[model samples]
Target: MTYRVKDMPACKGCPFYQTGEQGFVPDEINTGAKLAIIAQNPGELEELDGRPLIGRSGQMVIASLGTYGIKREDASWLNVLKCRWQNENILPREENILRGAVDHCTGAYLRQNLARIRPNLYVPMGDLALHWLTGRENIGHWRGSVFIADSGPIRGSKVLPTIHPAAIFRQPAWRSASKSDFSRIARELPKREPVVTYSDVFHLGVSAEEFINTIAALKGPVVLDIETKSTRPKSERKPIEETLAVIGIGWGKDVAANYVCDAALDEVLRAIESADVDWIAGGAFDFTVLTHYGVKFKWERCHDLILLHSRFDIELPHSIEFIASMWTDRAYWKHLTDTDLLLYNALDCAAEWEAWYRLAAFCKARAPLVWKVYMEDRPLIEVQVALHLAGMPTERGRIQAEKRWYEKERETAEKALLAAFGSTQGSATAVPVCATHKRYTGKSPLKARKGEAEVCSTCAAVRRSYIDSQPLNLRSRPQMIRKLRESGIRVPLTREGKTSLAKGVVSKLLKKYNDPRLAQLLNYWSKSTAVSRYFKEAWISPATGRIHSVYSMHSAKHRWSCQKPNMQQTKRPEKVLESLGDIVETAE
Candidate 1:
């Protein structure tokens, strides 16, 4: 039967929103459905349209299910999280602050819903889902495994973990993860008959025959995992497959083309998973997502990244960002703490985990809390601790001695920013790219049209200009994207529309991230000397026409970040910030 969310009695006129004409409460399956997918939350479009998987990420999800036997219209999806992940797109602090409430509702729904659906295969789409499944909030240990925890609905069925579909949308390279995922579905897919036709251009880079051959050649039991987002808050779980990006790329990594915050990270991740010849964070999330993407593996003897370290009496990291940035540059979470190192080569991808484990070992010695958390019960706590440990010792005597090093880093960073200002003394803040000028002129060098992605020259040149204009002082990518979006212009898109990677113009325009530019003017349309160092395009801010850069005081701790100035955030800028004042090059 077709289902629209039934507005639960508690949600009627929730203080957070203005109630509109009431709709059905999100259905807690009383019966009839065989398989249920638990996820994070509904996107704005889904809430407004009264449809699941119809939102930007949902579209890709609904389409992906077609590849298997599932259909949003046919099979039921129960989100572990509910509500519009409001304003996070603009003001993340507000979103982060509001997350506490979101988490409450999610727990209530799952506590009640799991008792309802009781499907044989409890598919938690991402790490969040798995958090509740394994009864542990720590992602390091839970990322790639299936366990019978006395929590959630996994008690009643085989918990099959698959990559979130959002990953494929964000990182096409993650198609490798999807291949095996589909194969898993194909195995369990009811043989009655195919009821749906999923129209997806994405495919496994290698055929199933080749995959099987590769697995045989390797000749050993493989590690496997199922990454699922929790139904309790953390709305990223809404699209089940988006979680796979965590598996492919290091969890929390977003160094791909465009970053929609979810799927965009998934594509680059797929690249990492397929490239892992020896150890790529050595976990099951990778194997499981690969399973869905048409790749297959035997998981009789799987090992966990945390287990390996724990065996060595090591502490686990809070997030992949710590290991990646602190340890492995090619690792996904590297952006959480370090500068952009676009891991464009296969060798870099292979070395990622080496860096990650190396840092994990190093940081274990310097962990701030000096406590131990089991992967079984500490996913969230571990992430927190890892970030804390990954922080560098600030450049100060007393503070370093007192271990108040973060303050020293802040002071140093501030001084650097001031010095950069001095270097640019009176260089009429190169006007932020105006829409008309950008359209007619050229784009950035990072986005310079190459091969078939067929980016626009104007867009490419403008991207280059932004690269040239960045002041020498910035911290990470989060700061960059935040400032760019605040400055009032379109953020670039990865081919996947995930991060503002400035790739395929056709892809971003075709999917989400569609900005209605007024002949290229943002609504606020104010001007600024400096925008967030995150993008090659212009982002809009509150009607002030002024660019605002919001800083998360603790954006980096345990590791490096792909975030710009928040520079290491993800989808590295078209050009490095170090070269900002240089003149633009003519490419078009």
Candidate 2:
């Protein structure tokens, strides 16, 4: 079954044939091998050697197999495009030409090869090779999961698409993810599609009594989730309750019941509260919103999958979709939110239930102490949920007064700076000198280390003058950098020589420089930024005139993150206390 150039007349008409490159790299077909590794196209070395997967990337793939005790000779190797698509200059051809080449070559060689050397496992590296094998793109979403293809050259084979080794070379963070995929491949789990049996009991004429009874009958650990019309309650004089669109409750692995919110609201709440142990994905919103509907639960009985996931990998995303991708065999269905609401919610409950056990087991086995700490801190979700709903009472009049005062201060600083140095009306190029007396180049390293380049004083003043003449806002990175430079403040650069203006950098610069203009600029920037941010975060409830900000315990390690009105970043706590003096009468 060796594919020779003379045996392939179809390749002569391929888009890559015009490049006059070396002959097609023949597939290293190992008949009866359980695994087949497919790559996008032949690299220069692969093409010259007239063999598929002979380059560095191919070796990395082979080494991953070796980690699982699978030798190189045990798996067949292939390339979607047999010949190299790039020319001698290493420049890829036009988009249409590349697509045409991939289409032509995959059909000509890959399919026939698969038929002869049928593999139980198919590993497609990169998107092009993945699309050829499974007719799917975006390897990021498809990778690390075994996909059972319905129809393709490698149909019915367990296809595991992973990040290309070349991609891992560019982004080293992907290496860990690639290793996870390799580990899954080594396990060689059976190919079985994930299934969830969902019943719309409310719409199907099932009584509310039956729904509650079903939930009560289930063994401990019920997963609860709710879809709502609005994330928060609409504050009004009469206390507007949060509207629930659908309530999803699932027990065990396969059964999930989705009930539309109507007369069954009380029953839905009862079913949720009756469960001895409940599993939820970020239950902060679900529990908080339920409180508005007069539903309360024993917080100790609840488990948040998001918090459980953080124990395993704190930095990785802890969303239900991300967790499910790792633990459950379910396909990606979050996109179905637009088309089918009930089914999407049902799928979410099923994913939550399934991912919870796997995540719990993984944490218990690998990091028992971490799991213990997570369990101890798990009850803190209740505290956070309560704090969010309780909210901070603030005077609308005081907020407006502070905002106006900051705006006036910003105007005063802007005027002083402009008056001292005349507005830059004409073009003036900045001969920006680095802080260490080095020349500024686009390729300069961002770090302000011993040899790294940074913004200079002269360039900073000149840039400030130009920005002062125009509208002022820190909306864009370039504008913010221009402002920072003009103020005679040293702005840090990233490795790619791009502006790195994080809050920490700004704070450090403010303390490092004592120049009057730098002080003025800081005053202007701080006031302007605070005023804008305050207004944006100021979503005060009309009924209580309080900010019900969302809070999270898992976003940061051993710390909480607040959003909406971020109370943590409040600059003047003394001022806030003084404002609340009237509410709390002073005792003599």
Candidate 3:
């Protein structure tokens, strides 16, 4: 049975009614909304207008929803407390009063309304409503997060908590975060097709001769995929001596073939080479790996799915599994076996072909300019592959010497710090009592006389004198904070009030402050971080006597990324280039 507010009588003795104000019932209460929005309470304007949300807060909601192609009428609006009490003193403050009202309203009205509407999603806004709905205290922790409502009439429905529009109006800082949350909701709400499971394509596995014949018969573009033993380059401790495992090829939807990449390798390579256009998910990685295995092909006609999809939606995940989930209805293969692996690879090729057609159509219809840019950037994928194949040479002696120098410099800095602050009580390291540390002792070091309290050795005045100081430890958060404080800069924080020390944040901070010490520290930190992260003993290729990193063109920005001794992020670019001059000449 459908329920409406007119069928039930209003409470008479409630504070909202006693205040000589009329009770409000939303006009579209029984409109059967698929999405429900639960708010804290009604404002004075809402009470007068006889609607749940018609105030400034409602306008914000309307505007945010409009950005994502949703109208205000698309969702049902309800409040945690049904009654409107403008006076703060008359509002329900005691737990018993609030709980009683919630119990009465939920049992009498909310349950029946929910049963009639059966909303797929519930969005709870503000502290009171969000907490009462989810039983969580910290609204900040729950905001912008999706959770399953376990109890009440909204059980089994997705609950996305967000800050109230009223809060955003009061605190402008929350505007961006609220908009981001709304954007995420929009992405998650789009309808999708049912997932496609394993098909009958595996039964079409062909012999080497059959594969050659099948490829020669194909008239259109072919989707290609290769399964390898390891995606990483050959390292000293764990070298990937054998690369290719299975070669999967798809010529249209149902017609697909896979061959064990042992005896039939040459025939498969010949078939791939003969194809007019080869579509690969990560073309750079695959092409470079094939080059290493003594199979070279001109990558002029290669259409990289990674680059194409990145051009369309840079933020979406570009992994084959993720892209398949987004574009196609394919269910990801769960089992891990040789046969399953081959089938997975084959299905990926099929999905790639389908995804390409969809993206091509989308670009042609909506964004012709973007399509042109993608085509122009297509040849650069081959250039990236070439760079990866030409492994960078390293001077082991110079690397060792630089490492030693940094170690000595760090030790000297630590000794100086110890002399400035004195050793910590019963501890090996010296810790200064700065402004932040003084909070623990309830003292202000800045208010204290000179030399009375332990002053920060890296204060603004002192740091300016040592403007060319290099960072000894790049990974140390405390050290980075000290450096920022000494340079009279505020640390960047996220919306949730946590420190944001990302590279972009640091880069902006350096540009704003323009302090030589901070600039030098950042440069040294970048180089030191690259050296420590990538230039390790296990990363060296024993067979080649040079570091060979696995490169992929499937990055979000269509740029190359190197893994396992990342040569793309060298410590000193000029030094490494000079050392690799002979190798570069040979490669050229």
Candidate 4:
């Protein structure tokens, strides 16, 4: 029997409907609807029109949906509170009113409608709607992120929380983020199949015999994945702290098994070594962890999915979760038990395997040359992994001393500037005597009118009007220019006739002037920037005593990107360089 809104007995005698206030906005249940959208409440405009979304907010929703080829007439649209309040801000001001409305409306109306429609996907719009449905408060944390709503009107449905269109209009800056969220929804809407779970393919707490039998029956060219405590690789601050939780192996598409890392370590290693081709995502981290755990295998036979994916689209995230979202049809990974980490690993391996083949075919068709180059560079990828494992040497003491030296130099420069300019702490009425005017006056009355009477030789406004005007940091630029002018050297100008403060221009000025103060300021600026970016304590691993930076081999025109104390840009200090000698080589 098909349930209809007209058949619902709760519609009659309802306080909202009885007011003759346009009654309840009945659900527009589209027969083709694979997804349902839940909004906070209908506005006055929607109530007047007797529809779920009819106002500006509704139009925005329709337009956003249209981007994904989803017609407004082809989806179920409902509100948490079925009726709109007469007062526009009544819902937000009176929390109890909304609670009472949801409590009364959902039990009688929403749940019944959901049961009838039974959408595979549920998208809750705005914080209020999301809170009513998911019991979560912060929309910012959950926006565009996928989750399973287990205890609500939309239970057993894949829930994707997104910012409301009204919110986007209120905060214009959120438009880009909202669009991204809509794009994710678009990607997920077409996939309505039940996700293939780990329990379906792998058995946990199995004996060594069971594990061996599971592996032995599997075919060659298997995709492998490992579950660990943390994503960060073994470093000094945190020695290989991540214990192997689960090791998952996928044979072909459907066949897969998960071996408990602690219990079946030996069996897992045996299976990996026996496989003709072992496909892994982030091979360097996984292989290093496995080797650290004393599981020996042939590294030459391993195929890194991350490196391969980078070859095709270097900017795309190569994480297994992201890859699963791209390649798989189901959203099963969103929900899992605490002990199901092994299952998660198994599913990740399956996703990686699927992505590997799809990307291979995609590249071969669209970019055959790129595909060939990637294939030829497979061995080089392995070499890169080895290089990553061998971390760079860092002298903590020398780096700290360099950082201190830069800070002191900057402090000295700042103090000298304060002395020359007579600090901002000086009285507003006291103006410095202009050398041209030879009196404590140049434009005192004009400056006093503007409430900037504390004029100085290095004042940006004064410099711009009466002397050299450059679009550099006013406080430092004027001082640099004054030093150059005092040294009988003309400051270099750009083609636009403005004072040029570019690196090359500044370097030339410094060389010609050879002023100690100018050199000190430049050194201070460079060193301060370096310390903040590269020598932070977070970059050094307390466990390894060396900087273990992760390298992205394809960023910035296919050049390597070094992070975690970016070794690529780490300026060699004399003390450190003298200690390490010629062996201190930067990354290639």
Model 1 residue 442 lDDT score: 30
- Scored by Cα lDDT, where does model 4 land? 0.61
- Global local distance difference test of model 1: 0.39
On lDDT, the candidate that comes out on top is: 2
A best-first ranking of the candidates according to their lDDT comes to 2, 4, 3, 1
lDDT of candidate 2 vs native? 0.68
List model 3 lDDT by residue over 53-81, tens digit each: 77788888878888989887888888766
Q: TM-score ranking from best to worst? A: 2, 4, 3, 1
**TM-score for candidate 1:** 0.36
Q: What's each prediction's TM-score?
A: 0.36, 0.67, 0.54, 0.58
lDDT of 2 by residue, 1-588 (tens): 223343467787787775343456778899878788888776756755777777898889889888989888888988887765322313253788877877788788777888897666788888888877777868877787776786766677677788789888777757767887888777763333322223322222235676667777777677888777755443321112357777777665556877777776786786676665554655577777776777787887778888777767776666676677788766667767778888888777777887887778777998798799888988997897788678888777666655555667667877876564445432345545545434334222222221225545554554444444555443354665665566566788878876777656666776787556545655666666666675557777876678777777776576888766666644643555565454344220
Give lDDT per model, in order.
0.39, 0.68, 0.60, 0.61
- The list of candidate 1 runs beyond 4 A from truth reads 1-8, 12-25, 28-30, 87-110, 138-146, 153-156, 188-473, 476-588
Which residue pairs does candidate 4 place in steric collision? 236-542, 236-543, 236-544, 237-541, 237-542, 237-543
Instruction: Please identify which of the two predictions, 2 or 3, would achieve the higher TM-score against the true structure.
Output: 2
Residue 433 local lDDT, model 4: 46
Q: Is candidate 3 or candidate 4 better by lDDT?
A: 4
Question: Once superposed on the true structure, which residue ranges of model 2 sit more than 4 Å away at CA?
Answer: 1-32, 39-59, 78-117, 126-138, 151-157, 165-177, 189-206, 230-242, 278-282, 392-546, 564-588
Instruction: Summarize candidate 1's per-residue lDDT along 256-336 as a digit string, tens digits.
Output: 111112433444344334543433334333443344454422232233454333333333332333333233322122222
User: Over the stretch 184-282, how does candidate 4's per-residue lDDT look in tens digits?
Assistant: 777677665333333345455466667667667665467766766655643422224456766777664455666665655776677656655555554
